[model samples]
Target: MAKKTARIKTDTHAVRLQTRDDVETAIKQIGDLQRQLEGLAIEQNNELAAITEKFAPKITALKAEIEPVQQAVQAWCESRRDELTQNGKTKTGSFNTGEVQWRQRPPSVGIRGVDSVLESLRTLGLTRFIRVKEEPNKEAMLNEPEIAGTVAGVTIKTGIEDFVIMPFEQEV
Candidate 1:
């Protein structure tokens, strides 16, 4: 009876670097490819910038023309807002071209001198207005890992290894 040999599975598409020289060659190739990619990116950006520069003046001129017209339309709308919106029954005025809307933004609070306000709130016994945030102190946990690791919910990971390949390149 002949013994059957076990066959190991291998990825067909994977690059196999058999020796130190192969790895070095791969790294050099990577560096060359990176330089080529960067050059292409720079060329693409230059072309895009030239295109933008060519269009910018026309865009600016159009915008300059539109601004005063838009202001005039807004002024007209504001002057006859009640009639346009049918005496506050609707917030939008629908014309043949498009609709203009009067939108009320949600109220917002702006605070200046936050420290002084917080101190005043504290002195006035207005603790309800003050916010107290509570969270796990990871730095303290790292400082005392033995105690931290004993906690049921927390798992302290150690000796994590990562493989990295950095191709050599010259700085411009």
Candidate 2:
């Protein structure tokens, strides 16, 4: 019988910037470095996704098995919360586990029939009590010269306007 052997290996290399004596050359080198890093990041993410895909079925099965137990535990906690608090116990019995306590929250409301309600409020002169929110149309603002000039100052500015780096091959 033969025994299998395990081995560890590494490939290390030094990288130095090769460029002409100018700011533009250095900038180009920096842009190339950024693109290389981005490519490596994408490759690593794809590898991780493949590993996750391999384990997904097992993970889903485990979750399905534990779901009923989780629901039972949740019900038990909710039912016993008042009794536990009354007995001056803010947490569960010490089994090297964390505490669980009930929390108080404000009730939430959902509005329906918004148009009818708005019309009623306007008819009853109760418009002041009703809140109105208005936002500038971004497409119209950008397309119209007058509107664009007016709203450009207050609009959220994004992206590089003057300077941008893109992958480009050197001319022969």
Candidate 3:
């Protein structure tokens, strides 16, 4: 006579169900680690602030002493640069110690009274130079799927989510 034994199936679902307690324990550990990290970061910032405060006065004084000498050197360099324009280059010039160059950027135009400009544009109904800008309303977008689909260059992604300790809660 032979005895038959039933064997259990090994699958991911079975394994997950068996290890549910382990998963919960890992999540708790991660939460504790995050709390510890936040506390350490705050403590480190406070210590750094104290050290910076102790040295700030000396640093300021050193910078103040160097300013006049630096300004004199810069003035002399500018004079030399004007004289050494023989190479037909306006941006770059080399002096005794090092090379000096001017880096120019494209000019940008800024409007000061934006509300008045908008009002004028709206009154005149100008569409070429200026037009009313329509920003996406978040609540409206969430309620309307058709509008969300029509919008371009928008991306949806899954982000890492974690539990945060509430400030009002007592320490466990």
Better of 2 and 3 by TM-score: 3
Global CA lDDT computed for model 1: 0.84
Candidate 1, pairs of clashing residues: none
Residue-level error in angstroms, candidate 1, position 132: 3.0
The RMSD (Cα, Å) of candidate 3 is 13.1
Q: For model 2, how does the per-residue alpha-carbon lDDT over 12-119 read when each residue is reduced to its tens digit?
A: 333354544554676567656765676799999999999999999999999999999878877877787667566655644222465555565889867699888889
Kindly list the per-residue Cα lDDT of model 3 for residues 93-123, writing each as its tens digit. 7777876666779999789898897778778
Which 10-residue window in model 2 sums to the lowest lDDT?
Answer: 1-10
Q: How displaced is residue 107 in candidate 3, in Å?
A: 0.4
Shift of residue 146 alpha carbon in model 2, Å: 19
Local error of candidate 1 at residue 91 (angstroms): 0.5
- TM-score of model 1 (CA atoms): 0.71
Instruction: Kindly state the number of residue pairs that clash in model 1.
Output: 0
